[model samples]
Structures are given as structure tokens and as C-alpha cells.
Target: MTNSTRCGECILPDSLPGVNLDKDGTCNYCRDFARKEDRNPHLSADERLRRLERLVAPYRKRGREYDCLVPVSGGKDSMLVLYAACRLLHLRVLAYNFDNGFQSARARENIQAAVKTLGVDLITYKPNEKLLDQLFKLFLTRTGEFCTPCNLIIQAAAYRIASQNGIPLILSGGSSRVFGGIQGVSQSKYADRAYFKNVLQGHVDFREAKRFVVENPWKRAVRRYTRTGPNLVDVLDYVYPGLEQTRDLLEKELGWRPTSDELEHGDCVLNPLKDYLQNRKWGYSEVTQSYSSLVRTKQMTREEALDHAEEEETRQPPAVLESFLNRIGMSREEFEQTKHRHFTEFPNYPQSRWYRMGKKAVALMRKVV
Candidate 1:
């Protein structure tokens, strides 16, 4: 592990499963980051806020039940979006939270406090517990990773609720600068319905598909673009005041509290376990990719990122691993057998080229708008 080659800029290593390094010792992920960070033409803060208003205005029409739907993870970014929707834009908001059984207590507390204080309505959804546990076990055994099921649900639920309630907008708290993808991992992208259904083909029935899967988002994106359906906008892209300032506003204006729960990944318990497993398997995890992104964004210097990376990568594995295993009815020996497996070993249902094309187009538009 000590002899492994690493990206000159980020802590990403050549040993990580699918990462490819350049002759200069930088990885492809870093190159992509540099391209987006350096070339994108983003709007000024005020114009950006105006951009948000224009995008949201159609949904904020008179007599609308909700001006927009904010998916709350009880995290800082979501809280910022919720605050902006209500206080900043003067828009009516509905908050949605999903408990996949791994939500941290502190996160739950924050959600309760946030919706109550903001005078917003929240819909908390917990899918069938027994079935969700089964799905988690299947993911861990088959792919050596388990976040996909919940992640898909989180992304899809907003669309589902918006569709059902006649809500015209879904405001995502996702910040590329905050929780952006690092890529090159098994299941690096969220599996489409085709992929998810294919995985469940021989293992489990897809009868409960509606509870966990989202249909082709490209089609959804088209609907959004044609101005015919709900728009799942990344609201933070328009209004974020960078990390520290956002945190200050979260704490001061909304009474948001950072938990002492030692939680990471938006205070979700499962992420620490994933970080631990990735370190054991590849000698590093997405934590390195994530923090390295912060370094590139100048949110943290390379020196600080290296130190923080080591601390996160080296910390003792949390007890959640055992608790998670217990809840999923898996034994330690079975868990050990699954570690060497990767999700890429399984077949991915072919993705639409249009989705990729449309995503690139939207990313560019967000900046130029």
C-alpha cells in the first residue's frame, strides 16, 4: 500500500478499482473537476438568485399548494434550500425525508427542528422495513456496497411525490461543490430502473419496484425542460454562499445545529462503514476523492486535505458495521466472503446516451444562466 501510485493533485490512487491516472500522476477524476471548475461560466450571486426566481416562478403561481418541494436530509445544504424557498424567495415549501433505517438520530432531530421552525410541512417515508433490509443484504453480498438502494429511493421519491401531489417543482439540495461524485467505483452512477430490475431478476422479485426505483430520469429531464412537468432543480447551484457562509446562515438564521454525533455523509451512519470497507479493499475510499475535491475548490488546501484524509481513512471502523450486519441478518464470516466482490462484475443495464448528453447540456446551461 505504501508503494501505491497516487494522483499528484488529489489523494486518489491508481490502485482504486477503475481510476486511470495520467502521465503527470493526476487521475481522470481530477481532470474532469479542473475542466468544470475552470471553464464553467456561472452567474453573479444576485443574478444567480434571480435565475433561481425565474426557474421557480412558474411553480410559485397563485393558489399553488407548494411553491416547490425541498427534499430535506436534515443536512446544511437542504436546510439552506428550505430557508431560501421560504424566506428568500417567499415561496411555499414542502419537505420530504426518507428513513432507510440508517438515518442518524442527530439527522432526525435536525429534520424535526427544521420543518417545525420553518413552519413547513414534512412527509417522512420509511419503506417496508423487512423488504428494505433484504435489499440491503442483497446489495452488500452481491456488490460489496449498499447505498444504491437508498440513494435511488431518495432521488426518485421527490419525483414520485411531486407527480402525485400536482406539485410543480422539486428543489434538490445537491451541491456539486459539496457532495459531488468521485466516479470509478462500482455502481458509481445511480442504477437506472433497467439496471435495478436486472439486478433483482434472479435474486428477488421486482414487485415492490415502485418503493425503490425511479424510472428513466432522462425522460423526466425532457419533461422538465419542455416546461410540461415538475422541475427537479439543484437549487443550491443558484443560491449557495460557499460552505462556511452557508453553515453560518444555517446556524444563525434557521437555528440549524451541527450534531456532536461524529457523523459524516450528511450524518448518515452507513457512509462510515463504506469508507472503512473501501480503505480495507483499495487502501483508500471516496473520502479521499471527496476531500480532494474540496482541495481543488479551495475550500481546503492540499495540506489540510491530506491531513484530514489520513484521519478519516485511518480512524477505527465504527460500530455501525456490526449493527448493520445484525439488522440485515448477516454473519461476520458471510460478510468477509463478500468483500472482494465488486458491483461492476455484475451486468449494468445499458444506459441512454441521451441522458448523458442531456446532463452535460444542463450542467452547461446552469452556469450560463
Candidate 2:
């Protein structure tokens, strides 16, 4: 709670809860063996297991029912979360993934393995690649960040499925604290439709985003699928599981094994770019942003987070940058210049927030090159 209390190892501020400052101004969260205890008391792993059991008991009684709908990417967290829902809680889980066109073959393989081995029903919604490419271009060139629609598309694909099936809960990994720190607890449950709508309203209309999509490949596909239906897409407040509980299920039930690469950091392919962007623009990586709050909350240590941060810069391959640049029809020089031009030339407004976000994202891309 004291601003003077800094983590002994990492750069986390003292404002974070559970941060124990030593004589060196370093907090306990920066040291080895980070403990979880803070202003809010979360259930322990064993207790979490019991709570999960109680939560899923009603659905388990319904027979062969998916007690929770999980949005997965076949990453470590996804694998871990899916395993927890099925084996730990003894509830059937419907594994959901919205393929945004950047998945690696290994990720796909892992996803298939989790679904097959766990005996959970799997549902996938893929945005057309052509549409995805176009959207990415617009996001990259026009908006600069993925912005609301891209986030919506991913959430919408899963929620549409949840709504149609009357699934009451959609389970996800982690919390908002994973991003903007404890003080910025703005993100509610990703499954809450009302919350999603309120956040979306802060941006632009779903119709505008859809207009961009319809003008692209997804529109063509949607036309083929028949458009007559109520809007099933929404955010809901399904359960949010913790890291410790997530790990136990992954280790015990799913027989999940981490690849050598995943032992340090993220299990997703998108992270390299995500890290690069955050670092270049925000002077931080997602891990820094993520674990900053975790340290305050006592869910993780500063040393553990810094260990992950060490891997961030090395993960981006030279070929990936070349490919990204080529795919966007811009060389590294052009990309850098274009980014600079946008920041200097673009008119500023509340509507232009996406442009600013994109600038931040682009700054990362420029730094990596």
C-alpha cells in the first residue's frame, strides 16, 4: 500500500497489495517463492477444487453436459483450463476456439490433442482468412490496434454458440488484472453481454465493424450461411479460474506436457508480436502489464514475471518480421515511416482513438525491425 515499497527484484510499484518491501526497496513479490494473499482472499487450490465441484454439480447432474464453455487456442493456458474443467470439476466441457487466422500448426495439433484425450466436445469458428487478412490490414494500417471489432469477433463467435445451446456459463483463463493492473479493474466477465455492450458503445458500432467485415470475405460467407436470426453474440460472466487450480488439472487429468519453449512464457504464437508491440510503444511487455497486477495481488512474484520478460525479446524471429512486412506490402523502412507519418499527420479526436492505439501497436512493430 505504501508507494515507497518497491519489489526487491523487479520494477513493480509499491501501490500493489501483498508487495513486501525489504531494506533494498525490493518487495517480497520480486523474490523467489511468491505467495498469494492480499486485500481479497481467494480460495486455495484445494478449496477452489471444492468450489468448482459445487459449481459444476448441477450441470453434471444433467448428464453428458458441458458445465462450462471454454474459449481455447490450444495454448498452455487453454490446455490447462480445459483439463481443469473436465477432470477437476468432473463436468463435461465444450471447448470453443475462434481461429483468427494466425494459429500455428503446433497450436492446432495441441488443441486437437486436448479435445481428443479429454473426451470434451470441440467447437471451432474460423473467420475467413481473406476477411481476416483484410481486417488485419485495416487494423494494422488504419486503426493500428486490433480494436473493438477484432475482440468482438473472437468473443462473438464463441458466445453465439453459447447462446444457441443455452449454455449458462463460459469459462475463461485469468482476470483483467492480467492486463492493466489491479487499480484498473475495468474488465468484467468476458461472457457478460451487457458489459460487452457497454464497452463496445465506448468505441464504435458493431454495425461499423460488421460493415468492414461484410465488405470483406466474411460477409460473403455470412451471406451463404443465411442471415436471419437474433443476435446471439454477447459477453457473459462465467467463472474465472485461477492459475494454481488451472495447473493442477492440467498436470493431473489432461496429462498435459509443456513444450520446451513454453516452460518460460506464453504458449501462443501471437505473443511474440504482442510482446514486441507492447515493449516498443508502452515500454512494457504483456507480462509486465500482466504480472504487475499479479504481484500486487500476490498471485505471482516479480522474479517469476521478469523471468518471462527475459524471453519476450528473443521470441520474435527475423523471418516473422520479414513476412509481416511483406504481407502488408511495406518494407521495414516504409513501415517505420508510415507509422511516424500517421502519428504526426493524423487528426486527433475521440473517434481517432483506434488510430492512437494502432500507433502504439505500430511502434512495437517498428522497434522489432
TM-score, one value per model: 0.88, 0.62
lDDT of 1 by residue, 1-369 (tens): 545787788767788766789889888877988888679786799999998888877776787688788888877878888889888898888899988877878778888888888899999888888988988889888878877788888878887887788888888876667654554463556456766776677888888666677666676667867877777788878887876787788788777877532123546778778777777777787787777667766777778778877777734567778889999999999998888877665555445576567778889999999
lDDT values of the candidates? 0.76, 0.51
Candidate 2's residue-wise lDDT over 19-114, tens digit each?
457787765544433443344466565665666566656544365355568888765665765766676566667888877655666667777878
- Highest lDDT against the true fold, candidate: 1
Predicted structure with the largest TM-score when compared to the true one? 1
Deviation in Å, model 1, residue 8 alpha carbon: 2.9
Clashing pairs in 1: none
RMSD in angstroms between candidate 2 and the native structure over all alpha carbons = 11.5
Prediction-by-prediction clash tally: 0, 12
